[model samples]
Target: MTNVREAALDVIEKINKNQAYSNLLLNETINKHKLIRKDIGLLTEIVYGTIQRQKTLDFYLDDFLTNRKKIQPWVISLLHLSLYQMIYLDRVPDRAVIHEAVEIAKKRGHKGITGMVNGVLRNVQRKGLKDFSSISDSAERVSIEKSHPLWLVKRWIEQFGLAETEAMCEENLQAPYVTARVNTMKTTVEQVLHELSEAGLDVIKGDLSEDAIKVIQGHLIETDVYKSGEVTIQDESSMLVARALDVESGQAILDACAAPGGKTTHIAERLQGEGYVQSLDLHEHKIKLIKKQAERLGLTNVEAMALDSRLVTDKFEENSFDRVLVDAPCTGFGVLRRKPDIKWSKKPEDVERITSVQWGILDSQASLVKPGGKLVYSTCTIEEAENQEIVAAFLKDHPEFSMDNTMIERLPNGVEPYVDGGELQLLPHYFGTDGFYIATLIKDS
Candidate 1:
């Protein structure tokens, strides 16, 4: 059997070096080693847990290393893996955790390194962990406690205040909820619920969107319902985009920046095979992903193309569509629960950089909306600069368009507090949803 702990260490090492994404690398290692179901679960937990709590783990480990400069990089990863299991995993006995870590160290390094690994693990087991209360600065305290970058925590605290930022950061540490949108054209939520329940999965209708379902237990992807295209895995917050677009049958729609077509397919499904959605992406390969998703959901009304959204007017006429969606890209701070590495991968400068691209996409897609038609600008980020500020900038530049407040009527109830005027910023802690932003705008007739 593959040593799950060692596999986790390998994945974490690559992640630290910026060599591979944690999820992709973990999946590749699992396949290469042919790990069993139990091992797969353990490996995934350790890899994600270590990366998720890397800062906090390091803060504790700092106390034990006498000369940290001398420790091998791989040894640090090994210690993080072991400490993550010891501290967070109640089911794992310290003796077994330390034993496996030492064995892996012995195989990978010399006697001196092995002794160091054994000593650190044993010390942490005996000494417990360092205290966060010692950190006097509130932002720094929250940053280390929640395992996020200090800069990010400070920015969030500045934008959202200390209490809300701390809450959002704490929420990011939890496991992401698995929710899927029912393909209304292919099946109803009730029908899919019955089908999933019969297959022995713990499933429930989503609390937010009527068309969403939450998978509480069992793997939905391995089931026939998902494989046969009756459902597509998407966050409930994301499923709100099509509804906010207020799609109608026989109305032409454009989905700018629509790769891997989640919202694009939702809009197409709502069209019920009547109207076509023109989807665009910068990369040809990602355009293929959008096409594949449309095909899988048996959606006939989606036409995907490879083109930069900034050059969209080069191909289509202005005022061309009844409704348009610019799900513009951002830093993706709102999805930290699923992509914890994002906390480490993204620098503060990245926010300033990506907002410019977002502004460009929103500007280009604005011209495509027919006069009196609706346009929705959305992103999976909580940053005001990327969310509300971008929308504010677009409205200022294009006086012909105005915020469409009727989106509240189209969305699910209980979202009014989040919706300021026509824009909604759904923070991760708000509804246990991914941090998402959506704004509905209308072109003047």
Candidate 2:
């Protein structure tokens, strides 16, 4: 049997030392260690819980710790893992957690270090952590309480008010339900839900999006329904991208920066296998991922190719495609619940850098939309810089395109209230989806 605690320790250490993404590292470690399903669950809880609660864990650890300077990096990871179980996991006995931490520390270090780990943890358990409720600063308190970086919390506070930022950060700590989009090209949403339920998985029709289904139980990707290409695992927020495009049969579309094409396939599905979707990405390997999705969904209308989105004009004639999508990559702050490592991986400067790229990509792809056609610019980020500001900047330079208010009718009915000036910014707390931004523009005839 794999040593589950030791496996958790290895994952935590590697993540901190190698700057590895927690989700990918945990998955790879579980596979490499050949952990059973039960152990895999435990390891996942340890690694992700610790990362999601790192700021708060350190806050508690700092109170009991006499000398933080002497603590080794691995020891810090070990303590973080231990405290995550003790605080968050109710079913795991507290004593069992402490004992495992001691044993892991002893295995990795000398007796002195193990004694320090035991003492600090026990001291925290006995005396309890420092009272953060008494802290006077609201932003700092929220940052520590929600376990988000102070900079990020303050930035969000600046953009969104205190209560909203607090809610967003708190929601970011919660696990998101597995959402999948039904391949309506081959099956209806009701049929897919019936098939999934009959197959012994607990699921429900999604509250948002016409074709989205939530997997309440079972690994969605492992289900036979998925293997049969009846559904594709995607967030409901992402599923809205195709609807935002509102592609029709035989209308050419361009998905600039499309890789692992979720929206691209959705466009092909909407096209009824008649229209061609030029899915472009800078990397050849990622382009393969787009092709793989197209193949899985039996979509023949998508053509995946390696090309830079900034140079779209170099690859094709201007005003050639009827619709275009620029899902510009941002800091990914919106999907923190699914990938907690993103919160720590990004910096304030990254938003600025990506904003520049988003602006460039939107302008470059704008010409591809033929006269009287539409273009949709989107990102899975809640930042105004990448979403509204980019669109605002684009509008100033190009007067031929105007905000398409009719696109609001294309969105999910319940989401119409959020659309203003032909743009929508979905917050995770307010909208039960990944925080996203969508802006639709139409070229004049």
Candidate 3:
């Protein structure tokens, strides 16, 4: 049997040393190790759990280590994996974890290092986590509880207030919900639910979108329903982007920045093959992804292209599209549940840089909308600079475009009044969905 703990340690080392994305690195490690189903489950839990709780684990390590010498990355990762099992996996015996840690350490580190790992982990086990609660500094307390970078925690506390920041941080630590958009072209929401139930999977209809269904606790990708392409895994917030566009038969639509084609196919499916949906992204390789999704969904109306959205006016005629969806790129703070590493990877300066690009794309695409047609600007982020602030600025400069509030009613129920000046912001903890922002605007004749 492959050593799941060692595999997890290697993945974690890669994350810290090579700056690899945790999820991508974990998936690659699992494949390389050829882990069985059970091993894969344990390895995934160890790697992600350690990364998610790195701050807390480090805090405990600090208390146990007397020398305060900086340990190597591999040793740090090894201790992280072992400590995670001790605290989180109550079913696993502490002795078992200790033994595995020593064995793994013997292979990777010297005998002295193995002795140190045992001493530190056992000391933590004896002390328990009671002392972590008494940390006085708000930054320290939030870091342990939320398992986020001190810089990010402080920034959120400033932006969202104390209570909301704590809530957002805790929410990010939870496993992301598995949400899928039913291929309305192949089946109805009810029909897909029935099919999933027959296959012995537990699922509930999404409270936010009529076409979205939330998988109860497991992944929907493993199910035959997903493999056959009857549904696509997407967050409820993302599902709303396509719905906000409200494509109609025989109307031409443009999905700028369409990759992995979630909204692009949704637009084509909603148009029912009568209208043409042109999907564009800057990378030529991503165009294949769009085409692959289109083929899977049996959607023929979508035409994938590789083009920069900032040059849309130069590439396509003004007033050519009846509808346009610009899912602009941003810091992606809104969807932290799925991509927890983003909290650590992003910096404050990135917001300004991405917002500038969003502004440019919005300005370029604004002219492409036919008079009286719809333009939907959406992002998987909750920052004001990227959402309302950008849209507000656009509306001020482009007098011909006006906010449309009626679009909120088109969204699924239980989506609270996130509409601020006709912009829909979905918070992660609010609807058990990824945090997202969408705004629909109409060009006046």
lDDT of 3 by residue, 75-143 (tens): 877888888889888988998998899888889889899999998888877887656668889876987
Deviating ranges (above 4 Å) for candidate 2: none
Question: Clash pairs of candidate 3?
Answer: none
Candidate 2 lDDT by residue in tens digits, 179-249: 99999989999998888888888999997888999988877787788988888888989988888887889
Cα displacement (Å) at residue 268, model 1:
0.5
Candidate structures ordered by lDDT, highest first: 1, 2, 3
* lDDT of the structure predicted as candidate 3: 0.84
**Model 2: residue 438 alpha-carbon error in angstroms:** 0.3
Q: In model 3, what lDDT does residue 260 have?
A: 79
Model 2: lowest-lDDT 10 consecutive positions: 1-10
- Native-vs-model 2 lDDT? 0.88
Model 3: residues >4 Å from true position, as ranges? 217-219
Better of 1 and 3 by lDDT: 1
Cα deviation in Å at residue 412, candidate 1? 0.9
How does candidate 1 score on lDDT? 0.91
Which residue pairs in model 2 clash with each other?
Answer: none
